[model samples]
Target: MMAHSPGDTAFLPSLPQLLIDDAVRAALREDLGRAGDITTNATIAEDAKATAILSSREMGTVCGTGFARAAFALIDPALKFEALVRDGEKVSPGEKLARVTGNARAILSAERVALNYMMHLSGIATYTARFVDLVNETKARVCDTRKTIPGMRAFAKYAVKCGGGANHRFGLDDAILIKDNHIAVAGGVTNAIEAARAYAGHLVKIEIEVDGLAQFEEALAAKADVILLDNMGPELLEKAVGINAGRAILEASGGIGFDTIKAVAQTGVDYISTSKITMAAPTLDIGLDIEIA
Candidate 1:
């Protein structure tokens, strides 16, 4: 079997610092492939100087300003980038995010790459904030799912944190989350639960995802420390919470959306995770504008 990549916690991943550096480097490489800003070379004179202002085109929680600056630095170390708004700061349309000034061509060249990271990361932050707000009054906290862009998990997860949602896990190796498939392969929930309890070391907690009350009951009976009540409706989830009775923590997941999340949160699950928080969230509409100075 092909090995799964690094830092995947079975539940959810926390950002590992080393991996963050790697992601930033890789993203810069993609933006600055061979040929190095041909458009800038052809038009803007080398000695010319200009300033640019990064601004928002829509309301959002700002994020990745440092990374965006780092992206420009990688392109040209002499570049001067200043942040007008810190990551996690809320900004409305037309608000200034940052200022950049250096070699005109270099600034022009680094524009797209820097803006790409800023916009993409801010999008995740923006959506995460919404979900977090939706469930703020309830006991449950908003969490991001494994449904993240491949190779951009850390960036997305970071934005989620910036927006006030907690991360689930980074990759499979970090945690032991036994879902429905594992139960089927192991013969039953009890069997899977037993296997996990028997095999995992003392520090590892066992979590299982179950689709219905029967499976949940089996998980509860088997003593799973964390029970993922997948796709269970509000009424069923309340029963699940009652059944857990302060034993296992319950997470309500599967097909959750903005319309239904508040209701799900009211069901008493300890947490609610959804892909809609990241996947398909529109870019927060930030842009970099040249300010000739």
Candidate 2:
């Protein structure tokens, strides 16, 4: 499958089942440990069955329904997990996101893991949506950084898309991003871009981070595919935009918040990347309530 870019907002694709299965399996193993859901084993009868509903307790976007379904299916194939709403859809309080029916013990065993993925991902989606909404009127798109939980980058990025945000390079291998450290090691911005250009294949696009107008001018001269305007407030960003005159894709990043995003977007940057979407997002509150039937 082709990687989703910051511009692809209309169609949100599901992650590969193999990837989902691998992640869900590891989580289940971590949670189950050596003995496995002992509390459920000790309390619930083996043959007992029950129904449960996964409901949102607060307003937010929904994500990770597939992961939640995988959690239940992996625990017990007999469990029937049904998604009431797809990922990227908004939900209000008391909305049911999914329903699970089957062995009561399996439902109980998988509940926490399911909720973990959904709640965490939904949080990122909700937070990203806020940023996206803030910049809706502008040409700038909100994008996510790699500041995600170590093993959860793919899942987190997917959630960002669900919330209407764009994605930056998934990893170092996908694109050439010359940061300050890379430039320092290479001796200068021009040298760094030259080195990356020589080494990277034609399919790769080169992007460089610049802190000042001088460096931005150098990057523009180097014909970098994308230029990251780091930590430039509204005034500086506007100046950078004016200087560019549509030479390359301009991205404004660094310390951008809800209050200032609109101003940043208004400066006419193509994208705004932030770590807050993945790092500082609050988990959306969701719960599984066992049906009394």
Candidate 3:
């Protein structure tokens, strides 16, 4: 069973088991390739059994224990995988998060892929946690954009939620977000919103992205459900907030970082979206140590 953290229950939904299993299977297949752990197959006896501990080398939030277990199971169905902690739980250095016991060859072969998922997902969670902490006192909520890795979108966004950030659109089809190019093609903000309304169902909300106050006013006049304030500095954001006067949900996007997020949050926007948390977060340091008996 997957562990759930109380802090993440609101933002993180239950992920589909089939999807996670398929992803892990693909990753294991990729690693196994043609030869398939030749070193392990040659060095270890086929019947040899061993135990391994997956431990964090640094402090961070955990987000991919399920994926790690799936990887081991895919490698060898009989492998015993125990998750010591659930996804979204925080951990410190020297903390053992999971234990795997199985055929020595299976354990060795699955180690790298399992560690890769856990470390990368945990890193995203940790990075997002910093932003969430910085803006905890503010009315604004932190969220992630569609700028996620191609196949890893589900896992990456899951980690973001684990770190206390919300998710924007799951995909392009999920909502109507009128970006700069959409505006340019549609002739203006109002036109884009109108066209989107006609193109989408009534349930689809119109979120128009504006580069400055001029477009902000147009989007506001058009009554957008959500307005994305793109690349606006603190001054402009403050002015935009004032002009908005609670007219719509304002989202601060574009190039936001740790140093600027607090100031952005202070501007009183409804949501702050950043791609750095998912795109560039450094992998958390985690390792697997094996013991053969």
Candidate 4:
């Protein structure tokens, strides 16, 4: 079994501190508002100190502990934040993930924002882990799509990595992915591949999406670096693999779910990209329980 300790980012590269701080501050702002945790301020003594336990209510792969810590730091610089489990570690129900000791009001104020990051990101990691585990024996690897929350792409993709999945292009500018629309606009699959290859330079690898064998052949003939096999059933995908013969990197995508992913993986595609890992992951049940000491 692998262990993830506090600040252990070995599963994936940590997101920039600036980005994490900005996001944490924004969440704190929204949570605090103009009144600033009115309930805590009204009921809790300003000078009171307390301890809060970050615990999991269900089994999941832990993530975003650092982000949660940042939330507390933004709320009160004096708060003592400690992570018991590292990111990417599988946790069981009732597990104590971390602890924060500091100003009671600050702890109460940071509770929601902290738990929100842990729960949401852990959900993505857990869900992606399921998909990754299913296809572990296959030649294909699970990957995440670009369908992520507007401001949380980096965080969501990081969770995917924690779950043992690979990441596709982080953004449109990161790589050239010519999809159906790009093909239609360019008049054909071959044209789209050709145009992408011409525009993208050696630094970029052009991947084109093809819905069927004809377009697959066209893209192959155009010497695309990678090919996306979109929405094709196992039979078609196997045929595509047979025809492809390793000429380019084959990615199976579109409507992939737990029920169909195994079959899709057996087709010998190099990658399986899905939106569910990021866009549809269910947030894990986690909470912060504060106890004054």
Off by over 4 Å in 4: 1-11
* Alpha-carbon TM-score of each model against the true structure: 0.91, 0.96, 0.94, 0.95
lDDT of 1 by residue, 1-293 (tens): 11111222344323555665566677767767887778889898989888999999998888878777877777788989998987777888999999988888878887887888889888888888777778777888788878898888878888887777777877887668998789989999999999988999988889899999899999999999888989889999998888788898889998988899999999888888888878977888988888854
Per-residue lDDT of candidate 2, residues 108-214 (tens digit) = 99999999999999999999988988888788999999888999999999999888888898987899899999999999999999999999999999999999999
Q: Write the per-residue lDDT of candidate 3 for residues 155-247, one digit (tens) a residue.
A: 899988888888899998899889999889889988888888788888988899999899999889888999999999999999999999999
Off by over 4 Å in 1: 1-21
Per lDDT, the best of the predicted structures is 2
- Which scores greater on lDDT, model 2 or model 4? 2
Instruction: Give candidate 2's whole-model lDDT.
Output: 0.92
lDDT of each: 0.82, 0.92, 0.89, 0.89
Q: Which segments of model 3 are wrong by more than 4 Å?
A: 1-12
1 or 2, greater by lDDT: 2
For residue 157, model 4's alpha carbon misses the true position, in angstroms, by 0.6
